[model samples]
Target: MKKKSTHLRALEGKSKSEKKKIRKEFEEVKERLEKAQAKYVQKPKRQKATTSKAENKKWEQKRKDRYNQRVWKGWRDKDMEEYPVKTYNIKDIEKDT
Candidate 1:
């Protein structure tokens, strides 16, 4: 027959109440270890939904329209600059006449 381990021998020497207490404590420690492992385990990444070419083109056009309306107010790039207007002086025109 195989000899019992010192730890097992010690546990065998304990009363029923002591054994029950030890078992309960062991269960609590096991539960804690499982919870810690679950907390540290890496979860799988979620996949993004793929859009069709027509859907992408429609979204792109909508985005462009919104950007043009919000940022440029339907004006083109060339019309957005601040140009200086030529003003005529009345005194200078009379003196010249």
Candidate 2:
């Protein structure tokens, strides 16, 4: 049988010190989590106003109609042939050698 490498043997079974340290760390984390959960347990339940499906549909339709009306009002009788031109030039400057 081949002899096990030191790294494999060390990692396969943790020493007592390493186990105790890991357990302590886990316990501390658990304690913190419990405290955090306890702190949030008494928080006020938010009363979100629930609108009905019909009301939601009505609101969405009203918004869409308003948007369409505004778009039609903005573009009606506007000249489609006259597009604006860019007024500035963006040429790269020559670098001094």
Best candidate per lDDT, number?
Answer: 1
Model 1 Cα lDDT, one tens digit per residue, 1-97 = 9999654665787899998887788779989999999998999989886898899999999999897666664344557644333478999999999
TM-score of each: 0.43, 0.31
CA lDDT, every model vs. true structure: 0.78, 0.71
Give me candidate 1's TM-score against the actual structure.
Answer: 0.43
Model 2 C-alpha lDDT per residue in residues 1-97, reported as the tens digit of each score: 9989644455457888886776787779989999989977887889986998899999999999998777666555474423333354445333422
Instruction: Tell me the spans in candidate 2 whose CA falls farther than 4 Å from its real position.
Output: 1-12, 43-97
Q: Can you tell me which runs of candidate 1 are displaced by over 4 Å?
A: 1-10, 52-97
Against the true structure, candidate 2 reaches a TM-score of 0.31
Clashing pairs in 1: none
